[model samples]
Structures are given as structure tokens and as C-alpha cells.
Target: MGTIELLMQGFAVALSPESIMFALIGAILGTLIGALPGLGPANGVAILIPLAFSLGLSPTSSLILLTSVYAGAMYGGRISSILLNIPGDEPAMMTCLDGYPMALKGKAAEALATSAIASFIGSFIATIGLVILAPILAKFALKFGPAEYFALFALAFATLGGITGKNQFKTLIAAALGLMIATVGIDISSGVQRFTYNSLHLFEGIDFLIAIVGLFAISELFFFLEQHAGDGLKKVALNKLKLTAKDILFVMPASLRGALLGFVSGVLPGAGASLGSFVSYTLEKKVSDKGTFGKGDPRGVAAPEAGNNGAASGALVPMLTLGVPGSGTTAVLLAMLISLNVNPGPMLFQQSPDLVWGVIAALFVGNLVLLLLNIPMVGVFVKLLSIPPKYLMPIVTLIASVGIFSITGSAIDLYFMVGFGIMGYVLRKVEIPLVPVILGMLLGPEMEKNLRHALVLSDGDWTVLWSSGLSIGLWAVAAAGLILPMVFGSILRGKMKRSKDGLVD
Candidate 1:
């Protein structure tokens, strides 16, 4: 069938009563989770995966719900960034540069409204891009051989440093740790234990879901506990909603530019939404500023929101097309798909066209839902800002604990989760990036398998890894990924820190 007809059928599936209901639920839940400080979309999605499974939703329905949550979380992230000068997630960090300033100047309503509009526009543009680009990319990925696949995985690892732009060494360390973790369990080729240490639990390898919850959700709990002392949110007054059409018109060009830039960033492996938001804000600040860009410019609020949201949509391109995630949240979602026995990649469209198109159509629907929901519900989310960690942490803990336990019913898994949580907390304390580790865990085995397969095909000829044009090109990109970050990381980090200095409290 043609892409258009497939999309029409996808809409039919997405618009089903059950799909719509779950989409709504995901949208609402995701926003609330994103509005909460430090939870982000990755954690929001991780914490809810068990819920989706326990509820017995079909794979398509579960994906629809989760993808809706992903979109909503992207929208919701701007809330704390604007009102509290505390980003709900890393991608939202850029929003705080001007969003909090606008809020401080009694333009909170305008900032929120502008960001919501920009987010919708960005996501809408990205969804269109996904509709156009994903299939083409998937078809291209069909040309990939084992060597090319190995090179692609290397490219993912090489570029992962862009997510943090802090320290490539630390990122590599985290990724190495994850790869080591991935080595646990029996080796598929040898059918012999590699790192199980004679334990049956380790025989199956560390469950990525357990690791995801531990690293993102459980560790977040520990971090909150450690940092919660004397950390209080100051209330911001929400002035009357007075966003004029002229105001919207003023930011349109910036929003469009940011969204396009953001989508490109999102499509690149490992660059993700953080890069999208950072570059969008930086570019908009340079080209359009009349010396009012950072002080309280609505365009400042709009640009990053557009950029990050666009990136969120763009990140799905690699995940759906190549089975390689473009961002941390998508990594978690990738794990969810694996857990559900649905492999995502080039064949996914041919094998599960209904699921792929349904997700795309649902994204379109979810964006509309978020636009409508965010505007009227701004006050509610603002109230959520005042909620204490004391009351909130337990619920996150409860949900995570219950969800993980429900999945395996294994006490050993729970103990391992706690161990991983402690490890995550320590890693965060040392300022090592976590996303790369997750990416490594998700991609390591696949990387190893591809490498071994390629070697065997060439009779153990290591040079075969770069024999093909496609493989060579991928290797070149991988080299650029590793080298560019070292050259540019400091400049980007400096710019981000300077922008963050605008925080009032």
C-alpha cells in the first residue's frame, strides 16, 4: 500500500475509542510527570511501562499511549523552567534563560502561552517531517550490512557526548560501564556463560527495564532525597492571560526557524533535544535579538520550546527507522518495544505498518490534545510546582517499585534494582552522564553481534569492517562525532552556563 493510504488506515486505528482513551490518559499523565521537577520524559516513560503491560494493552495501543506521553512530556517540561527557573528536564534547561525572566516580569501567562504555541508548531512540523522522512530513511537502512550496522552503532556511541557537552571522557566511562553490564548473561554465539557468575538471575542478563527504572526512576528518588533539604520553590504570580495575536505573530518566524533546526538535530543520532534547544536558542538570540533576547523576550521562550519539541518528534525517526534511538527517552521507548517482543527497524513498517502509522497519526492527535490541554490547564500545572518532594517522592517510589515487582515478581530483581539505583546515584554525584550508559546498554549487544557477524562473514578479516562504501562513510561520521565534541564541547558548555546564570532563585 501507498504511504498515504497506510496513514489513513493508521488514523483509523489511532482514532479508535480505546486508542483515543489511552492517548488522553498518557497525555495527561505525561504532562504531570514532566511538570514535576527532574522526572523528564525518560523517567515518565520508564515508570509507566509496567502500567501499560499490566493493563494488558496491545503493543500498538501501548505504543500509542507512550508516544502520546512522550509528546506531552516535551510540552510539560517548559512549565517548571518558566515558572520556577528549574528545568523539568535537560532539554527544558534552555527555556529557563528567558522563560523565568518573563515570568518574573509578570508575563508568566504570556511566556507559558507562547511556549505552548511554539511547542505545538514545532511538534506539528516534526510529525510532518517524520511522515516524510522515516520511510525514506528506513528504506535506506535496508542497504546496511553487518559491517555497516556495526559502524552505525559506533556512530551512536561516538556522538553521544553531544547530549551533555560537559566531558567526553566521562561519557565514555559511563558508556563503558553500560557495555560491561550488557556483557552479563550467556553469550548467544558460544551458548556459554560469560559474566553470569553462576547466578541464574544474571544468566538472562540484566533486564533493561530494571536498569531503566533503577537508573532513571529509582536513582532520581535517591538524588531527590539527598538534595531535598532546604530546597523550596518560590511562588510566581500568574497575571491575566493577555497574549495578543501580535505577540504570536512576533514569535512565529523565530519559532519556525527553531523548529526546523530542532528537527534536524533530533534526526541526528545522539544529538537529541538538548542540542536542538541549545542551538535554536543560540541561533535565535544571535539573528533576531535587539538586545532584549535574554532579559524577557517572548521569542526566547518560544524558540527553545519549539526547538526541544521539534527534537522530541525528530528523535523518533532513528528509533522507528533504524532501531537506534536518537535520544534518551527514545532509548527507554526502544527498550519497551523490545520487552513487548516488537522489534523496531527497517522491517517494522512492512511487518507492522498498522503500528508504525498508528503512532504517527497518534502523534498528530496528541499534539492537538496538548495544545488544548496546556493553555487552560496552566494554572493547574503551576499549582503542581508548589507540591513538595516529600509528598511526591513516595508516589514515584511506589509506582516504580510496584511496577517493577509486578513485572518479574522476583525479590532478586528488586535487590538488583536497588543496587543499580545506588550505582546511578553515585554516578550522578560524580557528574557522569547517564544517558550514554543507557544507550550503551541498549546497543552494546547489537553492536557486538553485528561486529562478530561481519568478521565471520569475512573470515575474521578485521579490514572488512571498512570495506564497503556505506561502512566507510559511517566510520567517517563516527570519527567526526568523536572529534567534533572535543573541539566544541567547551564553547557549548560555556554558553549554556552563561544562559543559566539568568536564574533568579
Candidate 2:
């Protein structure tokens, strides 16, 4: 089918009551989860994976549901950042720089309205990019060999810079741990037990959904308690959430710039929404002093919100085309596709055009739902900030427990979930990043498969792994991701110091 024909069919499905209901459910649930300091799209999708299974949703509907949550969470993240001075998720962290300050200045409603509009613009533009670019990228990826795929996975891990925390050693360690854990089950090549340990659960290894739920959702309780985050909450007074005509006019260009920037960044495997938002915020910070960006500028609100949402859409590009996820959430979505027995790659468009276009169509609806639902209802989401930590934390833990049990159907799975939660808590205490761990877990086995395939194709020739131009280019990118970030960071720090010195002089 042609792209337009497939999209039309997809829209017919998406506009149906069942698909629309699921989209709405995902959007509402995602907003609630994203507004929490503990959960975001990854956790929301992981926690709800079992729901998709239990409901026996079609591949198209299930994807629409999950992707809607993904899109909604990107916008919903701004709520807690603006109201509580707490980032609802990683991408929202940048929003807090200006959003909370705006709230402090009695402009909370205006800040939130700007955030919603910017998020819509970013998401809408990036969805258009997805529609236009995904098929082309997929066609390009069709020519990839095992060696190129292996190198691309390497590049994926290496390019995951800002989202994986600052300490490179720690990020590598977390990734290494994931790779090791992924090897726990019996080896397919040799038919030999690796880490099964005679346990039935070990026979299949830990499911990524179980691991993600424990690591992200349950682990948050520990942090909340340790930091005493619930007490002495900041109260934000909000009026009607609406942007003035002047405010709208001022932020349109900034939103456009952020959307373009974010879409480009998010196309890189593993870069994710946090990097998009950080880059957008930094660019706006340097643009001009007209609004004093750090001191509650509306343009500041527009930039990161647009970038993060744009990145959210852009992150799907690699996943849909190359079968490699750019962010943790997309990793979960990839896992979802796998569960539906649909492989995402260059052939996905040909093999599953209905599913592919259905998902794209759903994104359009989801973005619209986010804008319409969030803008006027910003006050409703803000009220959640006042929920007492004591009351809220336990309920979250309970929900996590229930969700895990629902999916696994095993008490042993609960045990593993609890164990991982403890591990997650310890890792977070030491400032280790969780995103790389997820990437490693998701991509590690794929990497092993590609490496083995490349060797087999070359008859055990190691140099064959770097034989092709594509593979060499991917390796070069991997090398650059490892080295260039540090150089750029140092340069940025020096510039900041010089600017401060000039101000003093």
C-alpha cells in the first residue's frame, strides 16, 4: 500500500471508538504518571504492558495506547516542575529552570499554558517528520549487514550522553551490568546453561518489563522517603491557564526552533528527550538577554517543552526504522512490538504497514488530545502536587506491586521486582543512571546476535566487523560520542567562567 493509503486506513482505525478510548486512557493515565515525581512514560508503559496482553489488544491498538502515553507524558512532565519545583521526569528538569521561577512570580498558569502550547507544536512538527522520514530511513537501513548493525548498536550506547548521568565510568558500569544480566538464560548457540541456576524463572531470564517496573516505579519510594520530599511542600497559586495573544506571538518562533533542534537530536540513537531539552534550554539561554531567561521568561518555558516533546516524537525514528530505540520509553515500545510478534526494521513498513501507519495516525490524535486536555485542565494536574507524600507514596508502591503481579503471574517475579527495587535504590544513591542500564538490557542481546552473525558470515574474520563503509562510519560515531562530550563540556565550562569574569569586570 502507498503511504497515504495506509495512513488513511490507519486514521479510520484511530478514529474508531475503541482506538480513541484507548488513546484517551493512555493520555489521561500518562499525564497522571508523568505528573508524579516517581514515574514517566517508560514506567507507565512498562506497568501497563500486562494490560495490553490481558485485553488481547490488536497490535495496532496496543501501540496506539502505549505511544499515546509516551506523547502525553512528555507534556505532562511540566506540571510538577512548574508547581513543585520538582521534575516529574528527566526531560522536565529543564522546564524547572524557568517554570518554577515563573510560578514564584505568580505566573504559574501562564507558564503552564505556554508549556502546553509549546509541547503541542513540538510534537506536531516532529510527528510530521516521523511521517516523512521513517519510510526513507527504513529503506536506507534495509541495506545494513550484521557488522553495520553491531556497530550501530555500539554507537547507540555511546551516544547516550546526557541522559545517563555525568559519570562516564558509572554509566559504563551500569551498562556492563545490564549486558551481563542479559546473558543469564541458557545460551542459544551452545544450548548450555549460563545463569539459569536450576530455577524456572531463570530459564527465561528477567523480563525487561519486570525489571523496568521495579527499577523505576518501586525504587522511587525509597528516594522519596530518604529525601523527605513530601514535607514542607511549596504552594503555588494558580489562576486560569491561558496564554495571552502577546505571549503566544512571542513564543511561536522559539517553539519552532526548539522543535527543529529536538527532532535532529532525537534521531540519534539513545540521545533521548533529556538531551533535547537540555540543548534547547541552553540555546535559549544564550539567544538573548531580552527576557532574562533564568528569571521566569515565557520563551524559556516554550523552548524545553517544545524540545522535549519534539524529541519524544523524534526518538521513534531510529526505533521504527532501524529497530534500535533512541530512548528508554521507545525501548519499551520496541519490546511491545516484539511481544506482538512484529519485528521493527527496514521491512516493517512492508510487513506491517497497518500497524506502522496506525501508530503514526494515533500520534496525531494523541498530540491533539494532550493539547486540548492539558491546557484548560492544568489546574487539575497541579492540585496533585499537594497530595501528602505519606498518603501518595504507599499507594504508588502498592500499584507497582499489583502491576508486577498482574504481568508476571508469579510470586517469584514479585521477589525479583523487590530485589531490583533495592538495587535501583542503591544505584541511585551512588548517582548511577538508570537509562543506560535499560539500553544495555534491551540492546545487549541484539549486539551479541549481530556480532555472532557478522563473524559467521565472515568465517571468523574479526576485521570483517569493520569492513564496510557504514560499519566504519558507525564506529567513528561511537568513538566521537565517547570522546567529544567531555571536550564540549570543558569548553562550555570555560565559556561560563569567562562570562562570569566579564560580568565582574
Best by TM-score: 1
Please give, for residues 214-262, the per-residue lDDT of candidate 2 as tens digits.
7877788777777755563555668655567988989998899899888
Model 1: how far residue 318 lies from native, Å: 0.8
> Residue 159 error for model 2, in Å?
1.8
Tens-place lDDT digits, model 1, residues 1-505:
7889999999999999998898899998899889987889988998888788777789999999999899989999999999888899988998998898898899999999999999999999999999999999999999999999999988888988876555889999999998998999999999999888898888989998888888888898887788884445665678899999999999999899999999999999878899999999999999999999778899998999999999999999999999988988898899999889898899999999999999999999989989999999989877877777877887888888888888899988888888888888999899997888888888899999999999999999999999999999999999999999899888888877877876666
Best by lDDT: 1
Clashing pairs in 2: none
RMSD (Cα, Å) of model 1: 1.4
TM-score of every prediction relative to native = 0.97, 0.92
TM-score of 1: 0.97
Please report, as a residue range, the 10-residue window in candidate 1 with the lowest summed lDDT. Answer: 228-237
The positional error of residue 72 in candidate 1, measured at the CA in angstroms, is 1.5
